[model samples]
Target: MQIAIDGPAGAGKSTIAKQIAKTLNITYLDTGAMYRAITKGVIDRKIDFADQKAIAQYAASAVITFKGQRVFLDGEEVTEGIRTPEVSEHTSEVAPIPEVRKVLVQQQQRIAEGTDVIMDGRDIGSTVLPNADYKFYLDAAVSERAKRRYEELQEKGGLNGKTLTDIEADIARRDYNDSHRAVDPLVCCDDAVRIDTTHMTIPEVVACVIDHVEDGTAK
Candidate 1:
């Protein structure tokens, strides 16, 4: 069984997906993190993120490992390093390239094949796992999402004088870029169930998703 959770950043998909995977005893695939790892690679090498050729080569040749929730890039533990605002910016720039997306999508698909997986990302339900047993499009209000990021970035460090407004504007731009990008834009699949989490607590949202899974399990 596969559960595909599609949502924008800071929408709680990553945490929920991890918990859901633990609840279900399945592997959790954080596809966004894979992209972030690639983005960090490009940034570390001081290569142009917009160069489709460079990005594609890096993604195709890169080794991304996820053990439990920790992600490694090229054998180095970069679980937290790849989550910085700079890496996020690089991700936005490189992830839209068709070649990069193509290679990463292939790798993501390979990882989830023949396994019970909970995969979360911008295009999982729409493109990567359209045939998933359960598909959810998780969302929240912009301010709510921004607040989540603000608090997380504060805890994570490396904000570098960036305010909530700066994060909000970055998120807004990412929303536009993800949804408007020419290749595999971020959008909900018609068959995906939409879960608006603006007012719901974490447990509430997890319970809601568990209910869906329980129902599917019953079938």
Candidate 2:
């Protein structure tokens, strides 16, 4: 049972994926966190984003793993570290590089082989798991998505001095980058069930997806 959920940032992909995985007793893989791990690595090493070759090499050799919900990089726990605004800002740049995507996508596929996994990311349905048994494309209005992110950061105290407006701008920029990238850009697969979550609560969205999963039909 492989489930691929694709969406832009703050569309509630991670939250929804986690709940679905829990309900179905499957593993949840946050593919965005994997890219963020690499971005964090590059930033920690002070690598220049302009040097795509170096970044790609770093991504290829980076050891990223998920122990349950926590993310690890190079055998170190970086669950919170990778979620910093700095890492989020730079992940868009790192994720679009062909070489980097090649390396991470291969890793993601390997993890899903013979495993009941629910994975979410920009290109999961279209690129990483094209043949997945269940594919969903989740989306919401930019304002709604940004507001969700702002509240989440506020709760975590991870805002890093960023306001709601700043977060909104950042999300807008990310949407553009993810959609316009040259390699495996974020896209809704033709067979995927598209869910507009702008007006729905988390449980509502989760229940909608669960219905489709159990009945094998799009609601």
Candidate 3:
């Protein structure tokens, strides 16, 4: 079975999808990390975000791989590198380029061809896997989402020297960009079940999704 979970960033899609994949005995794919890897590449090469052609060329040629939860770019492990604020800030700019999306979508689709996979991203349900066996859109109020992200950064270390207000502003900007991008904006499919997670715990969200999977509602 193929499952697609989509939402704006920090909606707990990645966390919930990971647990669901483990419970269902399937592979979990974090498609956002793929774009972040490319963004890291762009930053490392010092390519200006305004240079669309250069960004596209770099993204198309990038070799991205995932092993369990680890992500690699080129041949180097970038699991932690891609999580930095710099890469996160620039990902919205790189991800919307048509060429970048084309290359990554092809790779993402290839990974799901013959396996039980749970994929999560801004466009998975609406674009990458429209015919997936199950589709869900996880969401939360902007304030709640920002709090989650702030706590995440705190766990990583003192909010990376930033504040809750800073993270809130960042999330708001990303939400706008993801929803208004020219290609495959972040919108839920008509058939996708919408889960408002503003007041839901991670375990509760996971249980809710597993319920759908086992009850044959997702088939």
Where is model 1 more than 4 Å wrong at Cα?
217-219
How many residue pairs clash in model 3?
0
How high is each candidate's TM-score?
0.96, 0.97, 0.97
Clashing pairs in 1: none
User: How many clashes (backbone atoms < 3 Å, residues ≥3 apart in a chain or on different chains) does model 2 have?
Assistant: 0
Worst 10 residues of 1 by lDDT: 210-219
- What is candidate 3's lDDT per residue for 119-184, written digit by digit as tens? 999999888998998999999999999999998888887466788888889899999999999899
Which ranges of candidate 2 are over 4 A from the true structure? Answer: none
- In the order shown, the candidates' Cα RMSDs to the true structure are 1.6, 1.2, 1.0
After TM-score superposition, the amount by which residue 28's alpha carbon in candidate 2 deviates from its true location, in angstroms, is 0.8
Off by over 4 Å in 3: none
Model 1 TM-score on a 0 to 1 scale: 0.96
